[model samples]
Each structure stands twice: as structure tokens, then as C-alpha cells.
Target chain A: MDRLSVPTSRPLTRLIEALNRMPGIGPKMAQRLAYYLLRASAEEAQTLAEAIVAVKEEAVLCAICQNTADTSPCTLCQDPTRDRSLICVVEEPLDVLALERSGAFKGLYHVLHGCISPIDGVGPEDLKVRELLARIHDGEVQEVIMATNPNLEGEATSMYVQRLLSPLGVKVSRLARGLPFGGDVEYADEVTLSRALQDRHSL
Target chain B: MLGGTRLGEADRLVTLYTQRRGKVRAVVRGALRPRSRLGGHIQPLSHCQLMLTESKGLDVVTGCQIIGPLFPMREDLVHHARGFYLMELIDCFCPEGLENPALFSLLVDTLEHLCLGEGGERVLRRFEVRLLDITGFRPELHCCLGCQQALEPVTNYLSPSAGGLLCRACAPEQSPVHSVSVNTVKVLRLLREADMETVNRLNLAPDLAAELEAALRSYIQYVLERSIKSGVWLERLRREFGPNGALGGPQNGR
Candidate 1:
């Protein structure tokens, strides 16, 4: 049965349809959220709407790293205390946030925004790769750490970048693979376990 | 499976090719988290059996088991690129919900060959020819498309725009045609008709392999009306690593 045909009020139906379009939200969830908003105070609804609008209106892609920021070049790119000699390359702005949350990497970042995925018609030219190369050519960067995801597209993107950086004579490396923190080794997949074993370190 | 992207925090949108359904996109819930059982069975280039539940838009993958992960392809960069290239070919040519068992088997066979350490150039050329055949875009190799005469055991022209080979006498009429050697012609014919087992036994000279690759790539580009992305990456790998660098050394098995 169509959620739109539920005989709801016009404003309520509109809200349900809009919420249904969001990721991971089904018609049932959309309707539930719509009802919650319908009963909430007007100020609560206005604040939510305003936050969405503010994000779109205020967010800009940082010039150097291509991450979303309120200001151009972003705080990470402008920070003089951060190590500029090492650049960690990642696939998205969200990945930068995840890495930052871990607090393990203190180097600067270059967000490619996406990986090379032919299934989606995304290629090297479609990504921010040219900007990355330009940065390397114009800066004093020595090592580039490929921190793309562990998926196939991610691996390919890192390899693609590695090949391009090879000609520039800069040291290029990928993030070490191993068991995640707090994860049991017995439950790990064979591929990940094998990679972790191959990349094991000496105490 | 072709590949997938992380959907939400723990879910994934996976692209799969099946014998019954040509290509499918499904959502696998909790595929990203460490304890998710579905994560190991759906890696890109992996062949798997999936139990899906039909939803409003995309199907949901409820259960999965790995049939073949093609793990070696992932371990090596060149093999990995070639594997992705094969998947991209299917993704580009095959439409969703259309049944194509032959194409599906061809893909599985090619990936299996790659897993066995078969040279990528040979496997890719064979794959291209078979793909064109299954898709009804097989180019005429025995005779000229324009003059309709049997091609001689000499150099000929392959016209991508004309969709087949042209005799030397008729070559000038076509605005653009690639000069193809008789050896390349014979090899293409063999690949189109032979099984993977038979094709695997044959070894192509490097020059012939290069010629065959160029001709088929041009033909495929014309058919799709654009160049394939993986083909561009393969060419880039060739240019950067030399012929043997990324794709591995040429196999000369008789």
C-alpha cells in the first residue's frame, strides 16, 4: 500500500513524502517522524528546518583538502602547527572526521571526495585527483599515506594515486592493515586476517 | 558481485550479477560492522549465492555465502584492476532484471582464469570478444562488411563505425578503419568460437595481443558510444608500468 494513499492531512502527507526520500528512512519511519513533528511545538520544527538550511548555505569545500568547512582552506589546512610533510589521502570528508576522532593522525589531509568506481561511472578525472597532484608539485610534502577504504574501489584509487606519485619521487605508503581495536581475531574474516598477518610488526 | 558502497553506518548497497537476473542492486543491512556475517560474502569480484527479499525499490540481501572470493585478484594491484575491469564491462553492457546466464557464466569463467594466474591481456581480449558475441555486437571477422567477400590471409581493416571488418578494396569507403593483421583476425575468430579452456591453451604474441586489444577497444567504444573507464585505467597502467608491470608477464603456454 502506498504511504501517500494513507488518507492523512495534506501537510502531514507532504512531510512523510519528504522524509521518505532520506537515506535509511522507510515509509513507516517517515510517517512516524511526520506525526512527531506535527505534534511538536512550532519552534522545534523551525529550529530543525533552519539547521538544514544553514548547512547548505554556510558549508563550503575547503580549497586545499576539499573537505566541507564553513571557511575556505578549512582549519586543518590553515593550521601551521600540523605536520605538512606528511599528507594522508582519504575518500571523503566523513573519513577525515572519523580519522580525526581517533586522534591517531596529526598530519594534514587531502580528501578525494570519492574513489574510482567504474560501476557508478566515477573515474580519476571525476575526482579531486588533479588538485592533489598540483598540491604535491607545489608543496614540500615528502610522504603520502593512502588511507582510502579497504574496499576494491578504495584499493584501486590508492594504487592509482600511488602510480601518479611514483614519478614525483615522493615516498608513498598505505595505511597498515590489522585487526581493529576491541575486535576478536577468531571472528575476523580470512582476507583481513591474512592481510594483518602479512603486515604484522615485531614487538 | 561487481562492487558495493557503504549505505548508512552499518548497511551497504551491493551490486550483483546473477544468472537469472542480469544485474541487481541490493541493500545488505549491517554489512559494515565487524560482527556482520554478510560482510565477508559480498566483496567485489566475489561470486556468491544470495537470498534476497524484494522490497519497494531495491531488494535486500538477507543471506549470503561465498562461492569464490577470487582473493588473489585483490592481493595484486594489476589483477585487482583487471578484475574490476571485467565487472565494469558487465555493469556497462548488461541491464538490470534481464536474464543473461551466458554472460554471467562468461564473467565467472574469466574471473576464475584470473584467479589461476592467467595473463590479464589474454583473458581480457577473450572476454571482450565473448561479451560482444553474447550482446549481439560480434563483428564480422570472416568477410568484409561492405564488399561481402571472404577476407584474404593478409592485412585488413576493421571499421568500428561500420561495425565489422572491411576488405582492403572497400576500406577506403569507410571514413575510419583500423588496420588489422591476418593473425589478429584469426585470433579474434578463435576466441569468439572457442571455450575458455581452449582459449587458455593458446598464447598470443605481444604485438598481436596489442593489435587485438586496440581493435576490440575501438569496436567496444563505438558500441557503447563512449570509452569504458576500466579500459582507460588499463591503458594508464600499461603506460606507467610498461606492458608487463601491472598486467603481469605475457603467458606463452601452448
Candidate 2:
């Protein structure tokens, strides 16, 4: 606790505590990080600070896909080079990284940011699902890939999205098995994610 | 812990999942009272018919009757650790509001198998494989990730990172690979294809058992995204039993 008791700003203390709670980073690491930031040159520190601030200020939720982006239409949504017909829906921004790392998906993406959980009082309305439907309402998309994490919430979210999208007559596919069991999109290798994307079957 | 909380008493935490609701924590009122029937049924890893009183945010458990208690799970450390592993995985993997009969049945059957004397290892392996399938992380056991051709039973590398077998045709492309045997592939297939009851009946040799353990560990590492405390404890448990690994004496059917 003493190491964590930084005689600095309240915001710094709070960030340290929050970072400490994150998996893999211990209190010491959190404190070191906090102290390093405090000691860092103003211009260098501003780069990190500005990036964090810009995440909220510059990034707007893509009106169509709901992924955070500088533009209302995210790069994925805007990209004409990618498969406009295929939409890979995921739970969070990190999931986008996971898919991208796999070098497999060459399509648009929708970030739900969360899954439905009655226990947690998180309903479909809590997610960016309406925007997803709005995209489908345009009637050009051919396939919807439900790449929510392979966990309960992820499955439930995908199922909900699938049921919603199915009524619209668009093909809804799920990632085929090949990703590690219970593995998240973030950790999956390029090979596995690519294969899973290729083997995706209609739900 | 047995769940119950009222204005007069302290909070009691109980993990719950119902057909109507998914996984959640609720408190019961007066469950600890000596006269309370709720205490009789509300125990860890016990199957029960519970009536939930839907509250404003968190629900309350009004009543419950013991459907079955996984008594054998607690009797031994290996079974206990395994049971905890299943419960934690189910708790973490399953989200709230989703009624997956598949996951529920898998949990119940796997617990039942763990209680039974025969083939605990096989039952657990089968459960892990199926749990992944039901959720969506189905391993590509049939072929290599790159070439798309079928890999011979033992000719592929089991890469957790790559998500499945890396056939020799495509192995050079994938750098990190785990050496996998034909027996391992067959056992994994048996798990994927067989029902829980059939899976519980298979007799596993030491080598097969070790292979299964390795495969499952990596698979879990891939999916769970984080480590479970019980997993670390399980390693210690097996070491305590013997260097050969988690085998109980004749009575527990290690």
C-alpha cells in the first residue's frame, strides 16, 4: 500500500489502482508506471495523454458499425477495398485487433462493445445493435459473421444478433472452429483466426 | 455459501443460473437459520430446484430443494479441483440471460461423471471439448490450417495459437507447434464425437491421459484468456498424489 501511496494527484492514484486491478499488472508495476508517467518529459507524456484523451474526443462511434473511430464511418466501414458484403460483428475494440492479427478477415466490422446479460442488467439496447440493424436495413450486405467471443455472453450476443439479422434475409455466419477453445479474438493467432474465418458456416 | 439476506441479517452470496436467468449472484434470507430448509439444499455444486423471487436489480432465492449433491466431488482433492474448474469455466464462459440447455446438461453430466467411479479423465476431456464447440471455439482436428488438406492422424502439430492441427504440408509456415500423437488426436476426436455417457466409459492409458491433459491445458489457456486459481492448485494436487500425475488410489479411480 505504501508503494501505491503516491504523494501525487488524485487522478494518478485512481489510475494506479485501476491499472493494478487489471490482470498481470501488479501493484508495483502499476506504481512504477504511474511514477514513470509523472517523471516523463512533458512533451513525451503529452503524446500518451493526448492519445487517451483523443480516444474519447476524436473517436466517434461509427454510425453503421458502432466501432469507435475518428469518423462516423470507421475505416472498416469506409473501406471499399474490403468485402462490403461481409460484416464481422464483435463484442469489443480489442476483438478487432484479434481478427486483424489473424490477417484473415478482409471485411467490415461492427463492435457491440458488450453482450446481453439479464443478470447484469445489460440488455440488447445497452449495445450498439440498432446501428448494426440500420446497416443491414440498407440491404446490400451478403454475410454477417458473428465473431463475438466464444464464451456464454459472446454466444448469447451472437445468438441475439443472428436472430435479429435472420429475419432480414441476409446470410449470418459464425466462425468455424479452429481458434483455441474459450480463446478470445485478441489472443488468437493469424493462422487460426484466418482458418476460422474461412470455415465460417451459416448459423 | 448458502444464500440468504434480510434487513436483519448480513448478506449471503450464492451463485445461481436459472432457465429464466443465466449466471448470477443472489442472497437468500435466513438461509443459515437452523430451522431453514434453504440451508439443506443450498450448497456448493448441488443440483436443486430453486424458486427465484425476481427483485428490482438482483433477484432473491425464495426456496430450493436438493436435486442432487456432488458429494463425491468434495471427498477428494482431484475431483474437487476438477469440479471447481468446470464450475468456474461454466460461470465465466456462460453469460447472463442465455438459456443453453447444452451447457447446463454438460455441467450436470460432467459432475455426475466425476462422482461416478469410472473414467473421470475421459469425462472431463469430453466435457472440455464439447463446451468449446457449444460456445464456438471448435478445433480443426481434421486438417492443417494452411493447406486445407486433411492431416494424417499423427502427422500434424497441435498448435493452440494456430487453433488446431498444423499438417506437415503447412507446418513450415507455422513456427510454434506442439508435438501431437495419433492417440491424442483419436482421444480428442472421441471426446468431440462421443456423448458424455460413452465418454465416461473409456479407459485411458497413462500416455493418453497425459496427452489429453496437455491438449486441454493449452486449449483452456487459449480460450479462458486468463488463468483460474484452481488450475494452479490442480497442478499441486497431482504432484501431491504422485509425479506420474493426478491419479488417486484405487478407491477414487485415479
Candidate 3:
């Protein structure tokens, strides 16, 4: 049977199509979601729709850091208690959240939104690199922590940014790599093991 | 794997240029998770042996073992950018499931050479010429496109649109022809025939190197009908971090 020709209400089909367009949501899952929404109370469905709309409407990129936030500078950037001398550069806003949840470092965050992916047609200019440079022009920041993911694109993005930041005379550091806590050293990749050994310190 | 993208929340969609099958896309289950074993082994530009099972859409990677991580290339920014450029070329030209082991070998060998910190400019030019040849787009460097006469040891025009060299007589016929010197032609021809070892022995004068770079990039851009994204970044890196008073001094002697 032609899947598109299945007898269904137009609105339900539209909902399914919209859901299907989302990443990781296949046709069957979209249909399931649409049907579930149909069975739910009208108020519940309206609330869900309103929440999605509200997120799109309310979320704005922070002017200072380019992170998605409700305000221009973002609460984190405006927080006086946070260390203004330290900046943690991350690939995504979620990473900022992850680092914030850790509570180990009190630093401002700069989200590049994406990494330098050549295959994906993303380059340094495509990212918010110029904005990052502009932020450091005043020389308030002392050190920049490269907290990009431990992947090739992420590392390349970090290096590209680091090259730009070199002339600014700010101390740059990369996140440490080693075996995760409770992970066996035997299973670690050679690169990780090598980095672990190199970064090893006294007990 | 040439590169990969995050899939869903925990998995990864990877593109691998295989020795037997050419370009293949497969899913690495839970590859985004911190402790996923496949995550580290399936990095871009890393040589790996993968166990893939047939699936409905893309293949599923069930097992993987690292062969060469090309770690040294990652240690230097220029080397890493060059590696990405090579991978981008392969990804652009080679179609999926078109088994050409020779092309695959060329990629692996060039990557290995880059990782070993060999002369980058010559190696890249050699790779481009050889890639064009393997993919059946080799330009006619020896003969003129219009008159079919053997090229002379003098100033010539390289018509990217014509996909070859044109003698002074034939130059005006092509829409856009880059002024290529005889030395550039000789070096390009040498790169076409020479092994990686021979290429290592070769050095390019700055002007001649620039001419060759321009001519080849124009040809490649013409062929693809679009510019390679990495090429732009490579140029930027060279400008900012290249030999002339850049962050790193005298990179790869290019």
C-alpha cells in the first residue's frame, strides 16, 4: 500500500509528518506520537504545543557568549560571583550545562554552537570565532579552557580557535583526557592511555 | 572512517572509506556515550578494521579495532588540516560502494605520509593529481586540448573547463585559462608519475608553488562544481599559522 495514501485525518497526517521530520523519529514513531497526542486531553495537547512554541519564541542567543538563553548576556555571563578571568569554550550549549552541573569550575562559557566539520561544510568562519575574539579584546579574561568534545572535529575547532587566540597573550588549556572513573585501564585506547600516562601526577 | 556525525542521543552515523567497498555509512551504537568502546576507534582519519552487519538502512558497526590512529597529524594543526583536506577530496570524488582498492591505498598512504610529517605541499599536489587520474579525470598535461600538439617547454595555459593544458595558440579559445609556467607543468607531471618517496625529494619554489596550487585548486573546483570546504580552512590556517611570522614557524617547509 502507498503509505502516504493511508486514510487518515489531514491534521493527524500533518502532525505525523512534522514529527517524522525530527531527528531519530521514524515514520512509525511519528505515527505513534501523533496517535498518542490525539488520545490525550485537549488541554494537555494544547499545553504541549504552547510549550514548544514558547521555547522557540523565548530562546535567544546571548550576545556575549552566543549561548541560547532568555537574556542577551545570559545569567551566567552576568553573574558577578563567577570568575570573569576564566572562560570555558565549548562546542554546544548543552556542554555549558554539563560543565555547570559539575560545579567544579566557576567560569564564563563561550559556545561555538558547532565544531569545525569540513565534511559537513562547517568551517571556522561558520562558527562564532570572530565574536569570541571580540570578547577577549578588552583583556579581562586571563585563561581560556578548551572544553570541546574529545573528537577530531572538536579538537580541530579548539586548535583553530587557539591559533587565533595565541596573539592575545591569554593562557590556553585543553581538557584532560584519561580513563573515566571506574573504567578499566586495560580497555582504554592507546591514545587515551598514552595521554593518561603523560598527564599522570604524584599520588 | 573519514568522519562522523552525532546520531540521535547516544549513537553516531559514520562514513568510512573501505578498502573493498569504497565509501560506506554505518551506525555506531552508543558511540556518543562516554564509555562506548567504538567511540575512540572510529575517529576521523583513523585506519580501522570494522565488523559491520547488514541492516535495513545503513549498516551497523558491531565491532572495531584500531590499525593506525594517525596520532602525529593531530599533534600539529597544519598536518591535521591537510589530513582533513585529503579526506574531503576522497569523500567528494569517490562514490559509495565503488570498490577501487588502488584509490583506497593512495588515501591511506597519503594519510600515513602526512602523519609521518612528510613534505605537505608536494604530497598534497601528488595526491590531487593521482586522485584525478584514479577517478578518470586526469588532465592532459602533455598535449594541447585544441590542437592536440605536444606541450612545449614554454609558457602555457591551463584551462580547467577544458580539463587540460592549452598551448599559446590554443589558449584564447578557452573561457578561463590560468597562466601556468613550464616549471609548474614539469613539477605537476613529475607528481603524476613519481612515488611518495620521489615526491619527498622534490621542493617547489614559492612562486611556482603558488601557481601550481592555484591551477590545481581551480581544476578541482571546476570538477566538483563546488569548492571543497576544507580548502578554504586550509588557506586560512596557512595565512594565520603559516611560515611567514605565523604562530608556528615554517610548517612542512611548504
lDDT of each: 0.84, 0.70, 0.86
Each candidate's interface RMSD, rounded to one decimal?
Answer: 2.6, 21.1, 1.4
Per-residue lDDT of candidate 1, residues A1-203 (tens digit):
56585789888888899999998788888889999998999999999999999999999999999999999989999998899999999999999999999999989999998998755667788899999999899868999999998878888888889978988989999998768788777656667777889999889
Which pairs clash (backbone N, Cα, C closer than 3 Å) in model 1? none
Sort every candidate by DockQ, greatest first.
3, 1, 2
Off by over 4 Å in 1: A1-38, A78-81, A182-187, B5-9, B19-25, B49-63, B95-102, B135-137, B145-148, B154-164, B168-179, B193-210, B221-227, B239-254
| Residue-wise C-alpha lDDT for candidate 2, range A23-113, written one tens digit per residue | 5577778889888888899998889979978887887877777777788777777787898889999889878988999898899888988
Order candidates by lDDT, high to low. 3, 1, 2
Which of 2 and 3 is the better model by TM-score?
3
The candidate maximizing lDDT is: 3
RMSD of 1: 4.1
Residue B219, candidate 2: Cα error in Å is 1.3
Residue A60 of model 3: what lDDT?
Answer: 96
Worst 10 residues of 1 chain B by lDDT: B245-254
In model 2, the runs with Cα more than 4 Å from the true position are: A1-203, B1-9, B32-35, B243-246, B251-254
- Each candidate structure's count of clashing pairs: 0, 10, 0
CA shift at B134, candidate 3, in angstroms? Answer: 1.4
Over 4 Å off, model 3:
A1-5, B242-248
Model 3 lDDT tens row, B1-254: 88777788899999999998999999999888778777877888788888999999899999887887788877777777788889899989988889999899999899898877676777899999999999999999999999999988999999988989999999998979998999999998998999988987887888988899899999999999899888887787777666553214443665
> Which 10 residues in a row give candidate 2 chain B its minimum summed lDDT?
B1-10
